[model samples]
Structure formats: structure tokens, C-alpha cells
Target: MTPLYQVSDSPAVVSKKYFSRRELMPSQNSSVWQIQSGSVRTMTYLDDGTIVTLGIWGAGDIVGSALSTIEPHIIECLSAVEAVALPLDRQNKMVEALAAHVEQAEELMVIRSYRTVDSMLLKLLGWLAKRFGRTVDNGQLIDLRLTNQDVAEILCSTRVTVSRVLTQFEDQGIIQRLPLHRIVLCNQETLRRAG
Candidate 1:
């Protein structure tokens, strides 16, 4: 099977650049950065300085300000990142990236549409587990290192509310919190059914 973002037989030589956590990725209209490791969240601020998360991108995913028309587009590293710049001249590859971006936005919109914060958060956790988690003995481990504030930004909720809900989830055995903002989705299937 072919990789999702495969390079051509004669690919351009591009060096992978490292970015620290919370670092802002450099944007170039002529190219996009393909993630080699770690993850990033693209965001834009409203007039009131409220952050709106656009999307979360992981390995093999492409991201850049050029992909969005939102002013002040920013890609903030969620973890230590390694990425290589891919020229936008590759239309086919960029098309795939754009499609993925659209799909993710749609999915996130659905999750956010849930009436209650608990329901929205539950679905968001499940989505993240599916996309970025690794299977563990008991459940999937989400190692995104996302803060309560980060999650709140994604869901358009308050940090206090997110913290409370996360605690509630832990108390209910729905999730297990680990260090460095990691979480184990203890019973994602049950949560999915309940939600």
C-alpha cells in the first residue's frame, strides 16, 4: 500500500527542521510543511483576542498558512516537531492535504455541535484517540500533551469547565490522566455508545 503522503521517485531534497513545543512554524505561500513527527494546531484569533483552533495536524499531514485564508494564521507546535517543506507545485499532493483539512474541520464541527460540553469533549477525545493515539493494554493513550486551555480553545469552552469535566471523566473511570498532559481513554467504546 502507498503511504498517505508519498514522495515521487525523484523528490526534491528538503531538510527536516525541528521546532520546540509552542513554537510558531514559518509560513511560506509557495510551500507547505509536511509533518515528520509530533503534532501542531493551526489557529486564528478573533477581534476580541479569542483563539479559534482551525485544525490539528500530525505526522504525514501537511500544514501552512497558505492553506488557509484566515488572517494571522498560525501553526503552533504541540510537541517537539520535525517537518520538511514541500513545494506547492505538487498539486496532487496538496489536493489530498486540502481534502484532509476539510474532513477534519467537518468532524470537529460535528463534535462542537453537541449541546453539552461533556458530550462534545467525549467525542473530541474519541476522535483524537482514533487519529493520534497508540493502542495500550487497556485503552488508547493520547499523548498529545494538550493543556486544558488548549482543549478549551478547540471546543470553544472555558478552561475551568474543561478542567472540571476532565476531573469528572477521571472520577467516572472514563479516562485516566497521565503526566505531561497525556490521557488514556479507558472506555472509549462505552463513551461512544453513551454519547
Candidate 2:
């Protein structure tokens, strides 16, 4: 689908536009980067050796929203994903606009509270269900194509641990692995309980 910003620009505006129409322009200086599903991008490191997995942005989500203030970039995509690179000035403005929403501010607190790997995984699964789930004959099917290694990066855990947890869930009949890199939630209640 064409972005709203693209349709809003006039032909004259498009010709002299600082940002490309193909990119989702969050601000004037926005740039676009595209990636297929299942790729990795390196990230910046902290002095304390803490690695932050910003967010696994899917088809419609925006990236670099949180780190646009202090630094140019705080997180990098660990998988093949698209990122629209907004200039620092534009990013600052966007953050200010976002700050006005009380619900947006509260989301940061909720995200911060999931300090443990397991908690993060559970929370992420729940989020994916909400964002990209499709109702089928049996249950909700997660549309995001993710692997255990991808889960490890997002959850800040080893792949082994992620695999074990997934196996446990499968054994409990909470979810089932489908062909072509998909996962189906057999029972939402059971999955929530496991989480």
C-alpha cells in the first residue's frame, strides 16, 4: 500500500522533496532501507556490554523512534527488515509529537518491565498475536516469519533456551509448527498460561 505521506505530496513537492516518496517519511530528511525477512544487521554496543534489541519492525511499524534523541541510532535490525532513516532533527520533532500521547508514554514503562528473557519472549508472542495474527479454522496463526535464533536475539537469550521453551510449548499443545516458517497457536489460553 502507498504511504499516506506519499499521496499527500504534490508533484512539485515530490520533485524537490528531500525525502523519497518510496520511503515512509516520518520527517523531512527520512531515508529508506529495505530488507527481506530473516536477515541480520549489526548494532551499536554500550560500555556496560548490554545489547539492546530495539524492535522487530514488521511491514507497517516504524523503527528508530526511541533512540532518535540522544544519539543518531540506538538499535539496529537483527533480521531482514525495512527501516526508514529519519534525520536527527526530524526524529526530535517526531518524538515531541509522540510524547503528548499518555498511552505512548505508558508503553515504554510496560516494555521496560519485561526484564527477563522468558518474559520478553512471552510478551513478544502476545504482541505478534495482536499485530499479525490471522484467524483460521483452529486458532490464530502468527504471520511473522521467525526462527528460534531470531527469538533469541529479541528475548536476549541463547537459541538453545528458546528452542527448549518452544519445544515445551509444543509438547503442551499450546502451539504447533507449520510448514513454510509459520507457527499456529493451537490454544490461546494454554499459551498465555505457559507465558
| Best-fitting candidate, scored by TM-score | 1
Q: CA lDDT, every prediction?
A: 0.81, 0.50
- Model 2 TM: 0.42
TM-score of each: 0.52, 0.42
Name the candidate that leads on lDDT: 1
Query: What TM-score should be assigned to candidate 1?
Result: 0.52
Per-residue alpha-carbon lDDT of candidate 1 for residues 63-144, written as tens digits (9 for 90 to 100):
8865665567789999999999876653567566875676577557656766789988988998898888898987889889
Q: Which pairs of residues collide in candidate 1?
A: none
Least accurate 10 contiguous residues by lDDT in model 1: 1-10
lDDT of the structure predicted as candidate 1: 0.81
Query: Which residue runs of candidate 2 sit more than 4 Å off their true CA positions?
Result: 1-116, 191-195
